[model samples]
Target: MEQQSLWEATANERKERQALQGEQHCDVVVIGGGFSGLSTAYHLQRKNCQTIILEKESVGFGASGRNGGEVLTGYIGSMELHAKKKGLEAARQMWQLSLDSIDLIEHIINTHQISCAFRRNGDFHAAYKPSHLDGMKREQEVMERDFDYKKIKVVEKQDLHSELNTPFYHGGRVDESSAHFHPLNYALGLAEAVEEMGGTIYEQSEALSYRKESGKVVVNTNKGRVIAKELVIVTNAYSGDFQKTIKKTIVPVESIMIATEPLSEELCQDLIKHDRAVSDTKNLLYYFRLTADHRLAFGGSGRSSSKRDQENLFNNLRAGMITVFPQLKNAQVDYRWGGKVGFTQEMLPYMGQLEDGSYYAFGFAGHGAAMSSMAGKLIAKNILHEGGGDNPLEKARLRPIPFHSQHAKAVGMMKFYMKFRDRIS
Candidate 1:
């Protein structure tokens, strides 16, 4: 059987193949051409820096292309928790950084004129009971009073009738600034712009090994190898399988998604009066949104098994969607699939240089859409400093989860337990 790929699901779009078959060298060689790799290449080319992007498959073939396409506006870290860990000052900076990710993403999209099925409406945090609403209200109050989360507003159950098609939840919080788009298209758009800016991207160029020797990193690939003064490994979950160090940092978690056939304008409006995206307040998150063509695109984290193909390409998430919006019982599904998302033992991302002049970026967790993109830009900025500063890639100061060793089983257990709670909660 033909192994399935995320890129294969998109419209008949195939990136050009590399015809050259000789060894090559560059100033910087980026392995893994997903969002992080593409974004890093984009920024590097814009800075007039010499760089190349190597992908095991096509551009955006990883989670970047296959994500549920949510443009969330905040970090995965809870504000209250951050305040405790780093105090109010550092927590504020962390919160603001997340908001800035929104602006930076839009700026890139606009400057490049990428047709990515983009939108600007926000996402929602829906609740299933009054107690859930009350807890959300408290969270909202605290966030507004301390962090200026003014975009979040309380939604009552009565007001939900016209907004959502599901009858499951009582109320929720609506954030009017979060957006959703075609993730694959956006990733591709970035890839094209990066190449146009004079960056080299090699598809089917798989990195097999790398090593730091004599003050330079020699990277081995399937076709040929490139020795670079600086090396970046952005493979995320799909690391070369050659680097034990990188592999130990992130454990892959698969997320399932389903797409419904385009509905009539009237039917679409029945669910999203403002065309917003939604996510329920559960550990095993359920997220859904309206496509530009009036279809329902939904996804949720956590899976039934470890084998990527064993759980099946996609299981029916519609029953859960129905619980949220009962009006879609007969909705026609056009696609059903899932892809792997990597997370560290801690939910936070792991970025910055491991000692010895090599850069490592991975574990954006579930919020890779913005975090990965921002991380790449930060990596480029750090590379720019001819003199590495005291705070190279300031974002890296956040220490990685101490229990990186427990990431694999911990994440799987977390998902399994969370799903159990979600079904009952």
Candidate 2:
């Protein structure tokens, strides 16, 4: 399989924007150009904020471009967990925002005329084990009783074949509100809209460092610098050395994906009749969907960042894909790629002001596609001093993960434990 991602290979191209050169100034300086950064800039531009976006690479060069295009609903973990930890009201608010995030994506697509092949045909949460259906039942009940969400429809084991061609799942739950699309295309379209609204985006410019002085935050790049009233860091998994504190709050976990060569329309239909994005229940889950070109895009979790390990992971993903759909045993894989996703202890995205008074957002777990957009909007609202006192994600402070320096080892251990549990259960 080619190392390139299917999204990268199939996305529409856009002209490269110039990197930061000489000193510049804006009302807000966004430190990343992925979904969160571009979404923040896009919303800020609507408020007529003089925003400048600095990207180390092209837009969507990070997880925004590399993710499986599953625009799923709710936080990464279950709503019951959120309620148990954050209280029921807070959980309800977060639940509503999760739903709103999907709507926001649809609104942006329609308003901006983004041709990302978006579909709202819904998504399915397949029960990888028969016992997994009990958890799905609890989730469905919580959504109805507490969250007031009624979109989930549970399918029994005998009827599972109607929803999925696989014999792997015992049952499944379908959420008609969830959707999927071309993630890279959506990011590119958002970047275009940001530029159209007079927002400046520097493609190759990286935010090396930033300091607050004289009521302004000065962000310095390799070639230039940006001075602004506020700064927003939406770097996600690429936070790196920019801000060690923010980096420590989340662990970057490896996730890999493969796309099969375009199949016959008849075959595609047979593989997934309803064409809803599907994911199985597991700590290390396999999520997949059909691309607009009729290729099955299958992806799953991984533990290593090395190129050799990535090749192995790709092979493992192919095996997993074939396990789900035996007909794909001989199908050719066209593309294979992997990237790190920011995983937080809470399994939820967080957006708030740092101790330095600069605003930030990250740790979307696996919900970055839609939650990151909501993160952007919330960050913009907070920056503009708009009303957002009710959103739980917008906190007054962020806490560093305990023993974060060893997070790589910790994540590996956790993945092993989860895998063992999956095997036994």
Candidate 1 global CA lDDT score: 0.73
* Candidate 2 C-alpha lDDT tens digits along 1-425: 22579999999888679999999989999999999999999999999998999999999999999999999997666788779888999888888988999999999999999989999989999888778887788788988998888999989999887888888889989999999999999999999999999999999998999899999999999999999999999899878788877887767777889999999998898888798988888767899999999999998887664668767888888999999999999899999888878866665777888889888888887889878998898888888989449678876677777753655535654664376436433
Q: Which ranges in model 2 have alpha carbons more than 4 Å from their true place?
A: 404-425
What is the lDDT, from 0 to 100, of the residue 10 in candidate 1? 54
The lDDT for every candidate, in the order shown, is 0.73, 0.86
Error of 1 at 328 (Å): 1.5
Residue pairs with clashing backbones, model 1: 122-178, 165-325, 166-324, 166-325
Q: What is the alpha-carbon lDDT for the whole of candidate 2?
A: 0.86
Which pairs, if any, clash in model 2? none
The top-ranked prediction according to lDDT is 2
